[model samples]
Target: MTRSRKTTQPLVKICGLNTLTVVDAAVDAGADMIGFMFYARSRRAVTPDLAQALGEEVTGVTRVAIVVDATDAEIDAITATGVIDMIQVHGKEDPARVAELKARTGLPVMKALRVATKEDIREAEAFFGAADHLLFDAKAPKDMKGALPGGNGLTFDWTLLDGLKIDMPWMLSGGLTADNVAEAIRLTGAPGVDTSSGVEDKPGVKSPERIRAFLAAVKQTHLETAT
Candidate 1:
């Protein structure tokens, strides 16, 4: 089975953004999407008001609100801000929940599936019709301390996706950085890629230089792939 791509070039989403500076940097650097963490436990989390303020002036880049098993009120508050273009459910939300969120928020949903093995990938099929897009991320070890759902910066085996078939749009994520993203795309033939902790200086701090370097690397990869 062959995987499908949404565009000729791999789409880039820089997640876990909290400041306007990084937001501006991502947009200026030609990012396809920018994410705001709405989960309180995440070090990179931001309030709906803060996300709104940071995303208000942004254009051309899709703004995504990332949540982890959010309640109805929590989702309502985030969507009420009117700053998000997409909703990324990063927890244990099943296909039913994914569809419900789309109906409730009137926004496209991107369901994040944590992959530690082939079985996890197979389970993602449940969301095929429910979600608009799917994100494959590394599942942290159960014993790992201080691990968040999606931004733990751990990478999975890209080969796990080899020959796997899917009909909907999906993204490759987890520990992707300037150093390895090109190779990741080469291996998985992923149409889109997302990075959070990979571009950070520390747990929650994003470095402008690293962000620029990462984007430049992806751009170069796209250029090479085109030729």
Candidate 2:
């Protein structure tokens, strides 16, 4: 079942967080969610132990674990730490797998769809009943070098999501930074926004200043919209 919206404000998620400094930065900046990558291949990946330590620095923000095609054992290990509040599947997990993960972990599961075209957005329907939430991220081209499942810092045409309709809460991700997040949110009217590489100094190194700036921009947009 889809989770109900928690607040009226647009959610801000700072993803790919690995260090306590970045974790604290995100929480202090009023991010609604903070994501710790569990996919080993990604530079942002962190062990469950490290994630737990970093999570300790968080208080109110939801903590999310991002995994790509993890096995049952891996999932068990990650959940065992009791650090994650939500699970985000970023690989080729089908609707059934999404449901299975929720049943197995008893945590809300979010399915991420990497989109390059409108047809990709339509794929959200397949996960409707299973995933509690959805995340739409940019899909890197086939020939793009060193592109992991996400955090490529590549963006799709926002126009593709102009008339997007889905059953559950969703977030707009990919290539989002402080300078453009306001525009992205205005264009797509996304209930939430997520960033990984966008707030990074390099591929997995998060910039605390960028993180604060991004959150500030989102807050400004919300304030403007409310008036």
Candidate 3:
């Protein structure tokens, strides 16, 4: 299930990696993508120097830069580092901004939209041809105070995605782990899966063993589906 030459496999992404050891662990664990957070406010944020140091270790793995509602200057600065292969905008950027970034940076754009209601899910339809990848993570509840947009470790009801389909490739993130990843994929049939808080021992610390376990669970889910 890990290395499938036949069955179409899901890409596994390990986000919020800060240190070389953790980044190495993710790459060693066979993750398809490694994410580096640029939002300094988040506990998982890493300096550009740290990201470059860790990013240098990545060979076959795709390096992703995770940023918030970043301005064009910020995007320019991060993309200038020449380490990132993809840009993941985990913020309130609209479709126009996403398209602009894609035009300017020449990097594949991965837009993260927090879903709380069906309307929110439908809202991303406009970005279908505009974005390279679309991510659906749980939205910060309105009344809740100061919730980080992407890695809040919260999960929206999976049933919310029932029968949901989009022309764009998408992922199921938020509250995913080794324990429930199989169920999440079975429930939503996501083409890809991402994790940050789920594989962490704390806010930003990643566990290599956990990464392997989660990947195994996704494999298990695919097997169950193939039957």
Per-model root-mean-square deviation over C-alphas: 5.2, 3.9, 3.2
Off by over 4 Å in 1: 1-8
Among these predictions, the greatest lDDT belongs to 2
Q: Give the per-residue lDDT digits (tens) of candidate 2, residues 77-180.
A: 99998878999999999999999999999999999999999999999999988999999999999999888999999988999998888768999999999999
Model 3 lDDT per residue over 1-227, tens place: 02212223677888999987777677666678889999988899987778877787767777899999888888888887888999999888889989999999999999998999988888888788899999999998888876898898889888989878787778889989989888888889899999999998888778887877887887777778888
Query: Is candidate 1 or 3 superior in lDDT?
Result: 1
How would you encode candidate 1's per-residue C-alpha lDDT over 114-151 as one tens digit per residue?
A: 99999999988899889999999999999999888989
Q: Order the numbered candidates by TM-score, best leading.
A: 2, 1, 3
Give the higher-TM-score candidate: 1 or 3: 1
- By summed lDDT, the worst window of 10 consecutive residues in model 3 runs over 1-10
Give the whole-model CA lDDT for all candidates, comma-separated. 0.90, 0.91, 0.85
lDDT of 1: 0.90
Count of backbone clashes for each model? Answer: 0, 0, 0
